[model samples]
Target: MKTLLTITLTSLLTFNIAFAQTPEERGLEIAIESDKRDTGFADQLAEMLMTLRNAAGKESIRKVRVKTLEVSGDGDKSISIFDQPRDVKGTALLSYTHSTKPDDQWLFLPALKRVKRIASRNKSGPFMGSEFSFEDITSFEVDKYTYKYLRDEEVEGKATFVIEQFPTYQASGYTRRIVWVDQEIYQPLKVEFFDRKNSLLKTLTFHDYQQYLDQYWRADRQEMVNHQSKKSTTLLFNNYQFKTGLTDRDFDQNSLKRAR
Candidate 1:
């Protein structure tokens, strides 16, 4: 009888420990697990078509080529080069994202033959006239935000854990973001961004996710809608090639000018 009593007490203690976990702890655990599953993709290359729609329903399209290099112990490095539309052609944006520091971004304007650095204060502004801001384009790192688990709910037929995350970096445009992470795949299905005023600013949704190398999941389509401006931007991604032998040199400032 004593042995059985001790067993029961141990079980109860274990259950209580798990049930006592704070929301913040659970949120961080989820984020860590999601990040762990996506690790080890050396590099990636893809073609993208960006469509911008204004409140008046006016639409504009741009073609772009994207290259990314995974950085161990830090955030990834990425470079985007405009391909089509003669006016924006040869324009490139290079970014060096860090886990806990202000990200470095630069735009190379071929027409002006100069590289303009993106100031930290202006990171909140729109990127290339799109609804997505400069702060939105950077690679997501776990340490960049403090998280709190909100609740679990179904999002578009998938069970997801809704968590709220506040950016830890300086000069961020958003006060907080609520993300719906798919429970099965450990990837985000939807995100709602709140502005510095703590008002709902934008909603971003991912669609048609395809897995690469049986590990990484890539969203084929992403839509970002600005609630205040009534404008939206849709990114259609295609021709995804992973582990493309990309290197640090490919993401450097010099490579931005040479991108073709």
Candidate 2:
């Protein structure tokens, strides 16, 4: 029997006839709606503890602070500063994400006392020896993917819309992603990543979501597990503050080097 969501998509396609929307269009509609629901945060800041576990189950931890500014008509700008792990201490990464064009990124290395520009081509590489690639950590923009509705399913007892999203640009380590989005919140509950060769690579799960400003939802914890490598990274977010009046100046390359 077709579920309600499936029936709805089918009806949308059926009604349009010649101008019928494909599963892709219906999927994109869901994505756009999800994106719309999360808008208007203005800005936010959070502190995180990242735990990286190797195949042997040994773990190393790093402390970091993150700042993000929502863009008016495009993707957000963000800066992540590493405060722990003495060797990488005081290091920061600045990123300006665009919905349709290649993202711009720069890394501040205190050891070198200079900022290094990260080429778009290298965005697929591992970040700080963790399972997450630089591409995996960017702010999500709807235009970044071409989506197709997969099915309606339940994840961890929560009703979800399963959709397949294909990367619409280059330098992405993942060729595609299957996402399980919570029906009520419009936020993703889980995501399975496929490598460049379309092989299953990693799965990310979100937990302990709390809403802020009575509208925005932020997860307290996120875990990403690498299937082939048997490695994992867990990020615990704390002290989330929203609408803090952050601006573009706070995310610039120069500010990255000056981040304390």
Candidate 3:
């Protein structure tokens, strides 16, 4: 009888141990799992300043500075100013990207005294001679892609959740992207982009993260390298502000022509 009692007690103890994890703990685990599959590089924001540069050649460096303003459910508008290689001072490139349509791009050639619309198909072309394709300039949102959690590992001593995101946008050149996100910060650290043919195309890295307003995190710099072309583009971000009181009127089609 004592042996029987001991066995029953042991079973009860085992059952208790199995059920020790509460609903909250289980929910947290599920949330982390879901987060791995859904999180994007950045959340929605109002305005950002970016500087873009081409990979250095043997003799010179080429670069440009840009300011981007984004409005949810409308689109993004940007003003790009050429900065390097001396001959093109004061030249500006302006673009308004559409979520469901082809982007409208214009270039203000100070020397030509006109604002010329960039040809439509050229949307896939290089931007200002940089390795970055024009589509790269658009702000990335979570809705543009569908994600799946691939695995979990450690990066730079911090645990990371690895995920794969497939672009749903028709204009995107990439078929899929694999990202490594830090578990603690929920920020993507590395991304591998695959072309439409499923070939490895480019790798993107994010660094120098800073938290904003105690609620958001932003990466100060992003670098993208074309594996086949041996070229790269680096973007440095500055003066990021969120919830800047921007209105729907700011993102209207009429505003594109007047965007500074």
Candidate 4:
């Protein structure tokens, strides 16, 4: 009887501990697990076609090449170079993202023959007149936000975990972002951004995901809709290549300026 009582007591204690976890703790756990699943894949290269649509349905398109390098103990580094749309040709954006610190970003312009550093506070501004802000393009780091598990729901027939993440970056313009992460791939299917005023700012949806290397998933298209501006931007990604053997030199400011 004494041994049985001891075992029963220990089981009850463990159950209580599990049920007592706060929403914030659970949310962080989910984020950490999701980040863990996406930790591999040393590098990636892809092409993107960005189409911007105005309230009146006027549209414009730009072709771009993107490169990404995964970093250990920190966020990823990415570089984007404009290849088409003669006017924007030779333009390049480079970023080194971090978990707790503000991201370092620079824009190179062939016409000006200069490289301009992006201010941390200006991370909220639009990126080249697109619905995506400078912050939107930066790599998502788990430590960049404080999270709270909102609930579990289904998004487009896929089971998803919904969580609210409040940005920890000082210059962030968003009050919070609600994310719906798919249960299987841990990829975010939908995100709703709220501005500083806590008003709905934009909604981003990921579609047509394809798994690469039989392990990693890549979305073919991402659409960002601006609720207030009545405008939207669609980025169609193509030709995803992994393990491209890219190094730090490929993402330096020199590379950005030298991009053609």
Ranking by TM-score: 4, 1, 2, 3
Q: For model 1, how does the per-residue alpha-carbon lDDT over 1-260 read when each residue is reduced to its tens digit? A: 99999999999999998999999999999999999999999998999898999999999998988898999889889998998777889999888888778778888999888989977566677877899987787777899899999999999899999999999988889999999999999999999999999999999999999999999998999999999999999999999999989888888877887778
Model 2: lDDT of residue 20 = 71
| Superposition TM-score, candidate 2 onto the true structure | 0.90
Q: Please write out the lDDT profile of model 3 over residues 114-194, one tens digit for every residue.
A: 778876556457666665677666755555566666678887777887777776667577888887877777777888988
Off by over 4 Å in 1: 1-13
- Model 3 residue runs over 4 Å out of place are 1-60, 121-123, 239-260
Model 4, C-alpha of 14: deviation from truth (Å): 2.7
lDDT of 2 by residue, 113-196 (tens): 799887767667887788888777777789889999889999889999999999887777888999999999999999999998
TM-score of every candidate: 0.93, 0.90, 0.67, 0.93
Give the alpha-carbon lDDT of every model. Answer: 0.90, 0.88, 0.65, 0.90
**Which parts of model 2 have CA positions greater than 4 angstroms off?**
1-20
Model 4 residue runs over 4 Å out of place are 1-10
How far in Å is the alpha carbon of 103 misplaced in model 2? Answer: 1.6
lDDT of 3: 0.65
Clashing pairs in 1: none
